[model samples]
Target: MTDPATLSAAEAARRIRDGRLSATALTEALLDRIATREPGIRAFVHLDPALALRQAEAVDRAAKAGRVGPLAGLAFGVKDVLDTADQPSQYGSPIWAGHRPRTDAACVALARRAGAVILGKTVTTEFATRHPGPTANPHNPGHTPGGSSSGSAAGAAAGFFHAGFGTQTAGSIIRPAAYCGAVGFKPSFGTLHRAGMKVMSESLDTIGIITRSVGDAAFAMAGLTGGDYGDPEARPGRAPRLGLCWGPTAEQAAPETREAIERVAAAAARAGAEIVPIEMPEPVAAGLAAHALVMNGESADALAWELDHAPALLSPGLRERMEWGRDQPRAAKEAGRAAFATARAAVASVMADVDAILTPSAPGEAPEGLGWTGDPAFNSLWTLLHLPCVTVPVGTGARGLPLGAQIVTAFGRDGEALAWAEWVRQAAVA
Candidate 1:
């Protein structure tokens, strides 16, 4: 029989609400898939089948009692960086080996409020930084599944979970989602609550989700995004116009990757949306460098506790980066901020003609080896601008693997970006 876990959360919820399928059966199917794939995928850092089933059962019971919401009977996988009261929120570092939280992160609670079953936590790079996790791409285990939110995308792509939660400081969400061939959504900065989420770069970290379909990603955003927990900057609005640019950054993508995006752009243009390719004003490389600068400057504060004594427990990649950040002069941090401001201003000029911007989700498809997580060169600029971004799978790559495109919105216009993402995905499939 086909795996029930392969169905999107929105689809599964309908089946359950109509009594066409039991939530328990669906949860069992996912748990079984995870049982078979978890060993090889390592997508999950924690797994508790009993708890998941119990939650599913309760959801089914609630639905039977005429209680159901947008996510009734749906299951979700959260990243390790997000605190779960039931699961240990180890920051993927040995120093916090047994750490647990007494309260759920705001994002986790939001999922629960929507009646989602918390399947488990997925792997994240050490402290959601440069260190790669053990999770492999389901498409080709020989290759690396992108870093940080590695397991979340792998689980969704491998049919273990229909949808999973992830976060992006730089490319923790979109890069891995691209590499894994899944739909990744990073709403404009603070669109989703970040309370209880482990801090990487306070200014850059944003909550995101991964799913098999843009429709499902929208279903998730309908619930995952809201006003704010505490961040006053989280207010959101609508977006109408869209900015298009296929310049230096497009040139930067691997040849095959660029073609995939081109195919999608053509299809999008035919679908009645305006398509305008403009000059890529800001230096793409400079945005990446500034991201590194700020990331390094603030990382010391986030890792202060662990770095104080168990410095050796951190991964070499993270250790080296921390040390690099430690030595960075205050001037570099200021310069990075100044550079980000200039880029934001340039982005504003681009946004004037469009409601949002369209960009390639990744430089290329998932790379061949797992030695290093693929580059996040294409994603960091938007992250630095603190805008919302959603990755919609538009086509297969040169080798038949999935390829995705990024829908970037003006800062605080997350809803508009998501609407465009929905239209693009629908158009792509059509």
Candidate 2:
């Protein structure tokens, strides 16, 4: 029999549905893998083996009763920032140690309804911000796993789960996945339900997923999307007509990242995609600062209680950011909102001629050391514009760490982003 942990979510679901694989057996395989690798990787913050077994057994029984949902036998890792009724959700902060919610986050509920076995809570950076987690890159423990959603990406890359839930406030999802060589999909803002998710920045926070392949990502997302929390404007359609952009930020990215982007574009063009080079508009470029301003401002207000009561427990980096946010003039926040609106409009106008935009996922591979997660300069602009973005691993960098390129679409065009991302992945490997 194939090692169940090695199978993709789509494959596991199909096998379970066909009765070729038992949920308990699959769950045990993954659990065993986790036990073996987790000590070195530290991908999870909370793991309940007995509970996972019980869920798998229940799924097996449900299958026998002909009551299985689409994801009947798949396993998933939930980011700690996401509330989980069955496990502790500490949000990677000492202040919230042992915190558990009364209910699952909306995305978690949807996965459970789809019959997925909840494996564990993956480690997250402090409050899903710059503060690093213990999760080391699965490819090389000496290097960092991109922060915020560090464990979700590391766990997926390590084959601990078929897929995992992650959230991106800035580059949380994309950066980590790029670092860990996993496929990260941050849907159009509000495409996935955010209810019960710890709010970092309401304007920038986006729920996403991490998987080994684009197909697995699509499979997981199909079941998790569509709830009262998602925007109605995010609709599915078409293969992408891509407009490639290597903006001013490109200069800051490593040559390897630039090479990855160029490779993906060439591959897409070879695959018959209409790829064109374009420049970033000035207003949209200004939105980068707007993104930081809005995120910091909102986060400070959101964590006012913690800032006031337990500031000592917060990481120095986070504390500084919160303090800065609190001191910012209200006019700065307003200017950020206006800047984002202008940038969003600029993006929309440009999209009239293309289905999606392509860019580098991060500056480069995951950096050495856990003290700092790589920069989010490449990702924040899109987050500010409220566009959908997917980072597909293209190849390895000079250090042999994974490299990725991003596919982005105007706000609410998540389907287009995913379609093009899958296309690019397919073309690259073809």
Candidate 3:
């Protein structure tokens, strides 16, 4: 039998429902795996084995009673930025260390209610900003796992959890999942409620899921939002028309990323997908700059209390950025907002002829060293435009690090986005 710890969430759910595997057994396997692997990976900041087991036990009993929720038997890691009533949510800062919320974040509460066991709080960059945590890539400990969803992605890849809750202001979810060789699903803006989360950039922040497979991500989302994300394995009657968009970040892509895109395009073409080269509209391309301005400005405001009261506890890099954001001209911030509005309106035209856009999930592979997470140039445009984006591991880079291909669809088209991403995943493997 396959190791329960290594099973995808969809597979685990099926096994549990069929009485072939108990939720307790699966939870124990994951706990054992964490015990053996967590020291080197450092993917989690808080873990309560007893609590996890209790949840699993309850799930097992519910399954026996034929009253299981949609996510029964699945275990997930919550990003530290999200509130978890049972666990400390320090937001990766010493200032809020030992802080526990009175209620779970909406996403956490929904997941738990849907029968998913909370594994623990994963590390995040300070306030989900630039400063990274201690998490090292599971594939290469010497390399950095991308952030600020660092531990969520790493934990998903390391088998510590079947899925992870991640948020992306820029590329927090997709980039980290790419680096860690997992599937990242950043749905359309507001797809998942964000109440109780540490809000950074209100306009750009999006809650997402990180899973080992595209199907697992889709399954989790369907359970969480009660939306029809569709079956990942479902095939469309006609071949998909994919836009091969390099966007404005083409210049920033590493050779490996460029190669991965071309390789995936060719494979997709062979699989009957129409790969049409399309240029992003100027306004949408301009979102790269707008994203930076809006993110920094809003983040500064969001952390006003920390900046004023406990500035000493914040990281130097984050502190500097926050201070810069706090001092930005009001007009400059408004212009940035205008740019996003224009871009959001223009993106529809860009995708009018294509079912989805195929692009790079990150610059290349996970960069060496943990100090700087890789650039989010390839991902920010989509985030700013409020499009649905998903990344699947396509291949590996020169250093044996993983590389991923991003699939993006128009706003509110999450079901299609996930379906197309799964298609890309299948083509890459075929």
User: Model 1, stretches more than 4 Å misplaced?
Assistant: 1-3, 226-242, 246-251, 282-288
Candidates arranged by TM-score, highest first: 3, 2, 1
Rank the candidate models, highest lDDT first: 3, 2, 1
Deviation in angstroms for 269 in model 1?
Answer: 2.7
Tens digits of lDDT, candidate 1, 1-430: 6567778766787888788888899989888887888888889989899999999989888888988766776888999999999988997877888898999999899988888889998998888887777898998888888977998999888877767888888888998898888888787777777899888787788888898876677677775553321211122333234466553455579887777767767777777666777665755446556888898778876887777788889887788888888788988888887887777777676776776677888888788777788888788877887778888777777666667888887787766676787776666667
As a whole number from 0 to 100, the lDDT of residue 350 in candidate 2 is: 86
| Runs with alpha carbons beyond 4 Å of true place in candidate 3 | none
TM-score winner, 1 or 3: 3
lDDT of 3 at 65: 91
lDDT of 3: 0.92
- Of candidate 3, the 10-residue stretch with the lowest lDDT total is 284-293
Cα lDDT computed for each candidate against the true fold:
0.79, 0.87, 0.92
**Candidate 3's residue-wise lDDT over 1-430, tens digit each?**
7899888778789889899999999999999999999999999999999999999999999998998888998999999999999999999999998998999999999999999999999999999988889999999999999999999999999889988999999999999999999999999999889999999998899999999888888899989989998888887777799999898889989999999999999999999999999887788767677787789999999999999999999988888999999999989998999999999888788788899999999989999999999899888999989999999999899999999999999999999999999998899889
Error of 1 at 49 (Å): 0.5
Best by lDDT: 3
